[model samples]
Target chain A: MTRRRFCATLALCGLAPGAIATALASEGHELRLGLTPVFLDDQSIFLEAWRTYLTARLQRPVVFVQRGSYREIVDLLNQGQLDAAWLCGFPFVRHERRLRLLAVPLFQGRPLYRSYLIVPAGDTHTKSLLDLRGKVFAYSDPDSNSGFLYTQFALAKIRERSEVFFARTFYTWSHRKVVEAVAVELAQGGAVDGYVWETLQRSHPQLAARTRVVEQSPEFGFPPFVARSTLPAGDFKALQDVLVAMRNDREGKKLLGQLNLDGFTPGERKLYDGIASMAEKVANRP
Target chain B: MKHFMRDLSLRYKIPLRVLVLASITAILVTASILFRVYDETRNDLLRHAESMGRLLANTLVGPITHDDVWRAYEIINSPFQGGSLDQTQIAETILLLDTRGQVFVSTQPTQYPMLSEPGRLDPEYAAIVDLATDRNDVKPSVVDPSDSSRLFVTIPVISEGARLGTLVMSYPKSLFMPRFVDIAQRAALMTLLALAVLLPIAWYWGHRMAKPLVRLAGCMDQIGPSVPENLHCDLSESHDEIGRAGTAFKRMLKELKEKEQLEQEIMASERLAAVGRLSAGIAHEINNPLGGMLNAINTFKRHGPDDPRTLKTLALLERGLTQIKDTVAALLVETKVEIHPLSRRDIEDTRTLVTAEAAEKRLELIWENDITEDLPLPSTLVRQILLNLLLNAIRAADKRVECQVYRDSRSFTLVVKNDGTHIEDEDMAYLFEPFSRLSRNGHGLGLWVTYQMARQLNGGIVVESEPGETRFSVALPLQEEA
Candidate 1:
């Protein structure tokens, strides 16, 4: 009996480190990527496919973390719970001290997009934001550049406060939701991301056909993928390389096609100067 | 409706009644099954919604307690995102209300903003607030307010000791309609299929059942006051009710024919008796007066008439008296019953009497005599009956005349048949009446005399004529010697 017990002990000792190593490998190499509502809401399948692609390319496990609003994703990123996040330019610039830009999504062959001011299809007379006084308005998110900051800056330039210009306003927490609000006439006017609206037009034409775009803002830096500044350089570089080289790979190109994107670029910080200046102006308004 | 049905023919009425009854049963069964399906579906949907509301309330506890409006909003919106559950949207809107009955986080934030009173959004929301705050455990209820159609289910979010909030989910009532319609359609289809199979069977059975009755009715239509002897009713042998009716009708017709024959026989005999009494009185009165006149004329010729004129007058008077006596003798038929029993020779003598007429007509005479002994019937009346029938048959026969004489213990029968033209139905009615004028070549008094003689002897004569031949049958009951 003593000999049998000794043999059993020897077998357990031999299997312990292998099990521990497998567990450590599975838990430590997983990358938790955060997605904000600025991305389309109905892209769970796309997200899954992209996660699989990323895991295969980076030689590690990957997971996607989705939140309703940009603020939640930004908070998670700031708390170091997320390895990387795809966020709007406004939040990246606002928390530039703790976050570092990893990649910028290229739309229509350039890393720039625009914000739109939309109204119900029947509102023919409302050509610009000035004509929308006393009307209900919807905004995508406070941390959204094209969805929120651009509209605020435009209102500031006209010397009108948003609270006073519109009779009522509410945050929809999503660019697609902003379009939906305008389409359903829940809000007479709304601000949305042009790229998100265009993508929705392709995917759900009947829903997009309910609203009309009244104005398009000047081009601004697209929403970018970013990492926390404290992330290891090697891990950051690995994620950046995978994103930037997506156009050169077949699987990544197909995923990009589903996302309605051209490619990704390691963009410069000066590319978001227009949004940064607009944010500063909105904040410094009297 | 009763009159209408009574007037309808059995052929159409039977199938119509069966169809109406089957249709009523099918409709009732279909309605009941559809009602059950609707009830169960509604209950199942409500139960499913309640369970969903409870699970959502539990998940919202942490978010509601921490004041994470976005997380709570995302949790409520998750059910709307996936199309995996079903084609229909489960919930129209979901709301999270704070302990103060304020809208904390909602799927439609723009409509129901944070920290706003729930009642201000819509009047119907007041019911949800009341339900959430009224009891610790909120029950699901269908609330279709005037403006909107919705079914609301509320679940309270509670921690270890605190009630953090209420999770209210309102599903559009339209979602249950598709399931109800589906079940109703299936039930209706099944009912139609069953009716399709059963309706034809009912019709066939009804028609088969009504067929025999229709045939019996046709047979009844042929029956008149003067029922024919050869009426055919094929259904009498069957064991069904209609067959029994047919059997009864046939028996009634037979009795009617017999009664009609009896009445005809009585009329013929009564007429013959009346004629006999009148002729006998005439004969008696004429004979008495003529005898006296003749005797007086004879005495005058012998004693007082010596001139030529007196003699001529006497002779004329005698001739006139003799003519009157002879006319009266032909009219009188002897009513005396003869005591001599009928012999087979008497029946044979009829053939001899009609032989000359038959020879003149080129007719073959057939004689079938079965009797060898005398029968206790009057020979004179029997001889008269045989002579009248044979003479009539010889007159009417085309090529052949038949005479059959037979006797049993009770009666003597004679049958005379002639192959001649059939007797007309109109002529046959009065064929045996005196002076009928329906005979082919002679006065119709021969059959009348034959009928009278047969009746006097307590016998009957029946005539049956078709296209092929005419037959006369006389049956005389034998009497005891007096």
Candidate 2:
């Protein structure tokens, strides 16, 4: 089987890398990770490498529950239906009382990414989010930090409700979908994840060809892997150690390279205070 | 109404038709626009309500999944507090129904949160909950049956492939009705504006269009049976339909004038033909008699002259010859009309010639002359008129014919009266008409020639007749040298 296909199947079957033989012999615990489709994008090669390396380090079966919506994945994570999830800082802060940060993926050796507001390439009217008032808009997800929450925070800064500012809006449930929707003019503007948009621009230029970035939000903490607050102490520590030390292991390094990510880091809670403050400003907006 | 419309004048009819057509078109267009506006407003309102309902359902999904009823209630009540959630005033009430159709959370807390099961709640809600539970994949939509203006949209909250509950949102059509009304008002105003602009133009156009036709009609009316030969209308240069009609009318008038002239010429020709026919017979009889008289005169002149008795006889013969020559000279037809003054002697000579015919017919001829001075007129024309009247009177009178001639400051009148059968009323109207044949004695060119000659002299003739007395009067205006 192709490495990606094998790894995806193994992930679906909850088979860890070194524990594959043991997984076949005994009933292995299923480690469910709530994932948004934006980070997946059918990149089975990278997806398999990441899952295989993580599973090998954890020495347990790892399974992924793929839902297009961030809100759904966040809710699943909050409900403890998923063992852990890689969640945006906005949703992470939203469910902070019930969720705890495990680790944050570092890109360019830093745990930070910005929010991008984009429009069709030929559009010259919208130079920023404020110019998109009363226009049709697409948001990746209601819970997405860079895609939805940052836009809300920006509008909240001007004392405007995003729902009222836009003529009409709907969620595409994924950052790549926001780009595609904007490219096709299905939406006049979009709020999307900067990391996902840039990655697609480099890897799939054709899909990003017709979209132009109108504005970017201040850099915030990159999305971090999170688990329920009530997760067992030993299990949480094991997942955290595996993610932070991934750059040292040969297979983990290879997987990290394929994912265009540096090793994971123990993200400080204060690093996410910016997203939390924005989220609080939006939630408390009158 | 139909008869009234039919009887309306073209001037009124044209404008009325334009008004009716324009009004009907305006009404139809306005109605179409209003209907479309109402339809679109209704759809937009429904869509907006549905979208709000979906948003509320998504927001409540988290709290409901966590079984946090208080948070659900708080979220449901947010719209009523003039918050951003219901700033459009689309939702009137919102209720979160558990999977069993029990109202777990509601904005209208006192009235709702009904403890009833799925089957016993509002039928539409129950139906929606049933449908959502049966098919979690399908979105449930409902509108209140009792009031169509109120929309009820139900959204199923599915968490982890399990039906958590149904979110029922109540939104009335009142939210967008004002906007619809404003649109309708605008449409009506526009239609009225169009009508206001168009109607006057239509009226003016109709008036301009009808004017030519009205003028043409007036021209037609003026063309009566006795229309003057010089009648004309001025609409020949126009290019519209009415103009075309005017042109056709003018052409017909021209033809009619030509026909009238031809008829008058024919009447004059017929009179001349009658005169020619009588002249032939009169020449033949007069010539024979004149030859005998001339021989008698010549023999009398050659045989004897010195005796007083012979002298008297020769004078008598000379007088007879002179009278005949005068009568012949007076009867000759003259083409060119010339006026002359007449003295008492001319009347005496005319009476002397007609006295024989009157005596032969056994009629008493009474002649009166009130004119003392010489009368200046077309002598030949007056003589012809006098002779024709005298003849006709003599023929009609039982035993007496009266003739009187008078002169006034302005005119000269000749009155001829006869005690004979009166002329019939029907015949009197056309009595002066050419070739008018009433009876044997009247059916000739004698009277027709008299009528024509009088008109040529700028005079008029009238015949007034009753049972026993019929009078013919001829009057001519006296024109000075000019």
Candidate 3:
């Protein structure tokens, strides 16, 4: 694949609906990963701390790559080269064969984050998925639970129009990006994780001022870092054990502190299966 | 290439048209037939392969496994492998697949170079992966990406109520493609050969038709201004429409030539008659110059130009020049030309001139007018006829001149008479004859020219001149053809 397409594929790995760990548990060794876009020490400081910690503990170098589109990421994952990824819910439902999750992120003592459907501050749209019709809506990524899966479930409850109702729809690949899409009017409204919104309110009040919450959905599991099926069985076991025990250890807590998490939890594989089902229900939205 | 284009451009246009039309029609017909044949043949081949594939896959129904699919593929491809069958004969293919969605074998293995790799993935494997993983509802289906010109068939290998996987079959479709290329090349070569054969026949037909027309045009151009005309191309020599037309044309040309020769004779006689009348008028004027010059030269023998003789000689030279000028004026008047921008006043002017001339001749003229307001005759001819008659009457009149101009819808008449003369019936018949003078110091051509001028305008004149009264009248018919 071309370098540009490789980058796009790497980016799409996050948009795919799955935690990389579940896929990695069944995969062979090496744990090659297609990560989301890079960190700028802003909304992603926690990701860096976790990666640094995970690599140190696992005693293997962690590789990060950027991809352009969610479909390309899933393509790489299906190729068996991409052992793990942190993806949004779309690819998980789209390519469940190559992907699954491990542990989801937590902040302020909660294992979940509410998805905020935000629009411009003076916008007339009210609470409901149907109200956003003929308006541009954004998703942070196809894989993020709050960004896509839970919002997709909300849409299923109200109206399933992921394909058509909106005048336009897009992926911004991060909760902060989804909020920016709505704030800057690139999209009329978007689904963002509540945690990212709160942080933006604290750090960039101008961005927070640009948008207002039009609707809120029930909480969904936070973004998860997964391993691939290609990873050795022993390595997959080791990685999951370490992630579950991070809150109990002093160094892990300190590392977790940098990412603003209360603790990590032992996630069940079946916990995100409902996300896939939610996608199916919403796929035929009229 | 430049010369080719120039030669094409220089092609004789009439025949070029015929050749182009014929070649284009032939080529379009041939090409259309060839394309139709190619499409039908290719479709037939593909259809056969598809049915064969279905039958082969049916053979695998009890055994839709990897090994069975490979066996099926091998069995199907085996027929075309040896020299017994021509690969170039519209190559086409069919495929059989096992349940795992793998193309276990192909009819032509070398066609898909990538498939040679062991454990290699399908180029569209991503799409297959998505189809297999994402939707539980969409069953085994067939997709034809005709843009890529490949046909893919995915069959479900369902046995004993369990989904074993997908049986994927891909047809490399380029088999029929190369056949079309060969057919097109062969078709083009044949079309070229046909056009080459047909062009000369078109030219031959075109030249045969146009040859007579070209010859006629050449003959017309070569028959210059003064040639005698006749139907020279013999009608009796050939039995054809052209021969009849040539006979008719020659007769028409002969008639026209006679009319033209008659007109010329009249013009020459009129010129001679004018010369005679003009010579008399000139002599009187020239006599005055001679008389003055003789008197001046006698004076010059006694004195010089600085003396009394000089003024007299100058006066005589001026008189001679004036006589020459008067003769020139009359000559200009005689050669009748159409007065274009013809107007009502010009005819009136001629009528008035006749009356005035008769009055000057000291004849008690009796004049009458019965002419239309707008006479449909050129004023130059009108004036000439009136002047010629007046002049003749002045010469013949012993005491009186009688003049008449009258017209009805279809004719015009001019008559002049002198009561000083009368003639016998025999003499009256030749009264308008050239040089037949009846009186002393008289030019007889006046009546003759008047007679000829009338005829030129498709009319004639009669006269009665005798001792007591000589009458000359000219009648002109107004024909619509004029």
Would you estimate the TM-scores of all the predictions? 0.54, 0.37, 0.32
Q: Write the per-residue lDDT of candidate 1 for residues B1-482, one digit (tens) a residue.
A: 99988998887788788777877887787778777866776677667767877788888887777655545766777788787876454777888888888877777766775566778778888977876666465444555565767777777787775778888888777876887788778877877787788778877887788888888888888877677678877764686787778788778777888889889767766776777677668778888888899898888888984899979988898899887776555455555754787788887777788888889999999999998988777788888878888887777788999989998878889999999887987777677766567865665457776776787777887888999889999998877646
Cα lDDT of candidate 1 equals: 0.80
Better of 1 and 2 by lDDT: 1
Worst 10 residues of 2 chain B by lDDT: B326-335
Query: Which candidate do you rate higher for TM-score, 1 or 2?
Result: 1
Taking the tens digit of each residue's C-alpha lDDT, what string does model 3 give over B1-482? 66765555222545677667866776787678767876786566456544544454455554344333223433445456577764534234433333333343445433321123212444544454344333342355556564655555554444455554443445556655676678777767876776677677667766765565555555555566665445353233244765555566567667768878678656655765565566546765665765676576556655654644666666676577566555444333353464453245655576577666667777676766665466666667766787777776676677787777777677777777777656776555445555565535544455555665676677766665556877767777765745
The TM-score of candidate 1 is: 0.54
Q: Which whole-number lDDT from 0 to 100 does residue A118 have in model 1? A: 93
**What DockQ does candidate 3 score?**
0.01
Q: What is the TM-score of chain A in candidate 1?
A: 0.91
Please rank every candidate by lDDT, starting with the best: 1, 2, 3
List, residue by residue over A110-199, the lDDT tens digit for candidate 3.
Answer: 666567888877676566667877766777666666677666667667656465567546666556767665664656678877777876
Chain A vs. true chain A, TM-score per model, equals 0.91, 0.88, 0.73
Docking class of 2: incorrect
Candidate 1 residue pairs that clash? none
Better of 1 and 3 by lDDT: 1
